[model samples]
Target chain A: MTTTAVDILGADDVSRAITRISHEIVERNPALDSVVIVGMQTGGTWIAKRLCESVNKIVEGANVPLGAIDISLYRDDYSLRPVVLSAPTDIPVDLTGRTVVLVDDVLFTGRTVRAALEALNDYGRPRAVQLAVMVDRGHRELPIRPDYVGKNIPTHFSDEVAVGPNGVTVSAVAT
Target chain B: MKHLLDTHDLSIDDIVNILDVADRMAEVNRRQVPKVPALKGKTIATVFFEDSTRTRLSFETAARRLSADVLTFLASSSSVNKGESLRDTIETLSAMGVQAFVVRHKSSGVPLQLSQWTDASVINAGDGWHQHPTQGLLDAYTITREFGTPTSLAGRTVAIVGDIKHSRVARSNIDLFTRLGARVVLVAPPSLLPSHVETWPVDVRSTMDDVIDNVDVVYLLRMQLERMQSASIPNLAEYTRLYALTPERAAVLQDHALLMHPGPMNRGVEITVDPADVAGSRILQQVTNGVSIRMAVLFTLLGGDSVSSLTAGGEA
Candidate 1:
């Protein structure tokens, strides 16, 4: 099956989705002071920054700490997938009792999120974890769900979605 | 990345790749919380057929911090004490399915032999007067970290001084440093120099002071007084006066130059305490970087990641 690449969303949609995600986050945890935002490296990093900025602008006293995690080490499929290189996992704030809003670009097999959760456990116990994603490509092999999602772009099992600062694109071998 | 038996197996690209991945591994050591889940389900066997204070402990710590289950075998108390051959011990452990074996043997080529005996990766911790690949790797990683560039050593000079005949660290470093594009030199007494010094990819000098002022890094190898027993070196004072890094020699180092040592030093003999304790000394840093380098080695070999992937993340 030859697959193809196509632009799915533009910058405006991403920006709007993040703003909505920011609102949902603030409403879920009323004060927003105890919520910590963490981005998955290389992709979730930028979106998490934008989300944190939006979250700060919505509430007074503004400061919500941020950190980044490299879930490559926590991955379960080292025997199956091309491994991602290790990056500095800088968790700036203590996660104990703080609400961690885990951020990522695309929510697919739920494996990445699963790895992220396992990685975070090494840091410390969080009050709770709520996943936020810019795109939900909906073929989750694991029974996992994102609490705040920007757009739901259902895709073929073979296609891959890549979310960047400017926009999002889905690609697969051209069939 | 698979079975780091020696630095000779590494190309410039392979050497640089190990350093780049080591950059990420080094972060785990420096993190506020010193642990990672990189090798969570993996089992690592540290088989030391020789006495070791640092390499054995460092490998065990590195494995543990990465969350890997560790099984240690010391030759003195193990079945090897009961007359079992090295092959028997290894095959016994391989039977239990360790993903990797960090082997340090008194004889050269044991790591290579063990690698042949099992599918598990074999890391040469220290094998006779052969290769100590991880030591070479951590040293490169330390230098790369200090300079903030992996390729910056291309034109630099690194002098490995003392005990060239008996030091495996010297052998591995020469292979690694030269591959990373550094000019290497060996400085030791005539009796202490290796038999094949002319064949190695480095210059040889009768004394360190001859080229001491020109090098970017002055790497000192521990003077194996134990091995010098049958050699012609008469006394410790003679060895010190000729090769020991004294306070005066330390002052002559080029600006920004570093001093590195693979530890368990004969302090007053090969190097004085003052020179070793200098501001830019990379001795302690080498020890700390050991864990991360080994972590990268174990991960790349067993993670099903192609060895080429070691060069993937860091742009430099």
Candidate 2:
């Protein structure tokens, strides 16, 4: 199989997007003390930590709880594909009556977000839940949507959008 | 990968994969809910043809925690007494859409036979003295976690004490520990040792005193009195004097050396000392880890498409 890779968002652009999203998080959720950030495992953990750091920097003496969740157990594709656990879920604080911001690297079919939502319930009942993603490649199979998106780059179903600390790249596999 | 009949069927990759997933399952066990939707709508039937308390409950708890329905079958209460064959029971359950079978039988190869007769995945909880793969995995998981090594026990040494011939746990652990790069020493009387012990990948010790102070782990096996059939030892007192994890021998162990026992420990026969008093004892941790390991097994067999792909190298 042949593939073509193109850089979608440069490193500087990705940084700017994270900074902007962090500001939006603080601005929208006035009660930053009650807000927690949880990253979807493997891909979104780094971004979640970065977002937490940026959020704390924007607010003095703010100690926002950060966690990482592996949603493999809650996914609906067990019969269709292999399911392997990625990382241990580490929710440091009870989410009851607090807001949760779920971070992920890419948002494509919205199925991962759905699984993340179910995974969150095992932690605690949060007052509200929100989604944050670096890339929204738009092929949603569910009624889920991201609250804060860094970039929305539409692509074909076969295109793969990968987000990393370096940047974001969209690989087009020959069909 | 499809059916976990024995530890001999697992590759290094498979063992590591199950241990890694068990870590995740351990975290789930620590959760506020202590449950997941991984195996929702999937049904698991535990068919115990032999007597067991811990293994049966552990599998049932693991299945429930994963949100999978459980069907409990005991030979004593079931139609087996009414002359129903094992094949009839397995086929009946298969027709009822059982996704997996956690089988424990007094006769060896019962799980393997069931696998041949059914389409559902067969997990051999314990089949006579043939194999208890989950016990092996949990024991390996316990040791690996204690040593703070996530993958292998490359240079670690384990001394398994007592009843090697009739111990399914011993058979499974030997396969698993060696596969994970651990040197195993079997400490048992010649009468209690397996007939083909020379073929096994382990060193043989006639007494615990020979290897008590050196090994990283001291594993005690239960004495199968029922299976003894004849006098395997002179007497229980002599057996305890030679093989039990007595306080004198326990005191000689290295400070970091671990004490382990597959449960229903014969208090005065195999381990005379109080497990709680032993500073390095992981007897309870082994029981706790059983749930996590079995959860990993159940989820691996029923909640995934293929074990090979799930355990394949690289980022999951």
Candidate 3:
């Protein structure tokens, strides 16, 4: 199946979105002294790092901890293929007392986000975790929902979203 | 993703997908920017209950290339030696924010148990003689790269020589080769070969010479002296005489046939062939392909792109 690329957010637009999301997070969670951003590998990770940078720029002296998470091994498909172990997670800052902003590129079936949540639990329990995504395209099979959404795009189940250096586009097929 | 507990966890499609990704990862090495920011800011913890230099180093290198942070926990230095439980150690690492865990244990199925205990992704580095899935993958990648796309090993005979009953590498390779259609022949002394070899899919031959000339590939397995209680055979000398891949015996193979070994070689005992022959043996290729194959796995699992995008990227 082939997916048609539908433009939802561009590089410039993503930057703006992050800036706005940062402000929203700080405003909503007033009690937190600092925030740590954890990306859910690949696109989520990139977005999380960018969001951390943006938040830092807005709030001076803000301790924006950044981390990347790889959930490959926790995947349900482990038995079905060759097992490749990637690098471990590195969260320089402690999650014990900090508000965690979990960042991802796209929110579709919510399986990845669910996996990310499970992965995060292993690290330690954070004071709170808020989900943020560049695109919330619906079709969630789980009860999970993103707290901060950059853009909401209606899509068919057959369609898939692609986020790259260029921009965000929806393809009818996953490609 | 549940941790890959054993080869039984993988289907044919999973194997093919990993190989395909490994093929792409091989190309990454040739790029100006070998580092992919894909895993930037992620953490991967390597919890090795066994002493492994190659496997540990390879996993560390793979994670760094993808820009992920890594923590290496050696069993010797850790509480594991002080009677610290595996579950306790893993749970502690999990609490430390380790997203992925690369584990190696002396006991088989330790990774399986760890998978159930924590939320972190678990990759089995080695678990007793149960399985070494990544080793099998890299071997397959090496063979495919050397001999062209492994269409089917139907006519191809693979002679696996060495400690058959003790080497997890042998067990994993046997499974992978057989699934890809290769007829596997286990070459070992009666002492080394398990008594129930007949139950396995491959043929078991006590005489190395019987299958030496007929096989298309001779995969030499390392003799894990550490694992053996008393010598399974009389001694290393007798074992070498009967099972070692000596230079003289290697000459009997067809000119087109290849030799393979998963390293940490036993020198004169398991292989009478010179270590330099490993250049021609495709052992080093297996090592190099290891990084590429692992990268493929890391990216495929963490890329976050849809299946269609991955296909498009593959085509591109």
Using lDDT as the measure, which candidate wins? 2
Model 2 CA deviation exceeding 4 Å by range: A1-4, A173-175, B227-229, B306-316
Residue B17, candidate 2: how far off, in angstroms?
A: 0.9
The list of candidate 3 runs beyond 4 A from truth reads A1-175, B226-229, B275-279, B305-316
Alpha-carbon shift of residue B162 in model 2 (angstroms): 1.0
Q: Give the Å error, residue B39, model 2.
A: 0.8
Write one digit per residue (lDDT tens) for candidate 2, span B47-132. Answer: 99988989999999999999999999999899999999999999999999999999999888999999999999999999988999
Clash-forming residue pairs, model 1: A2-A173, A2-A174, A2-A175, A3-A173, A3-A174, A3-A175
Model 1: DockQ vs. true structure? 0.35
Instruction: lDDT winner between 2 and 3, please give it.
Output: 2
DockQ scores for all the models shown? 0.35, 0.48, 0.02
Kindly provide the TM-score of model 2 when superposed on the true structure, using C-alpha atoms: 0.95
The per-residue C-alpha lDDT of model 1 at residue B178 equals 82
On TM-score, the stronger of 2 and 3 is 2
Off by over 4 Å in 1: A4-6, A171-175, B275-277, B305-316
Go through the candidates in order and give the C-alpha RMSD of each one to the true structure: 3.7, 2.7, 13.7
lDDT of 3 at B157: 79
Candidate 2: pairs in clash: none
> Global lDDT of each model?
0.83, 0.91, 0.76
For this target, which candidate reaches the highest DockQ against the unseen true structure? 2
Error of 3 at A169 (Å): 15
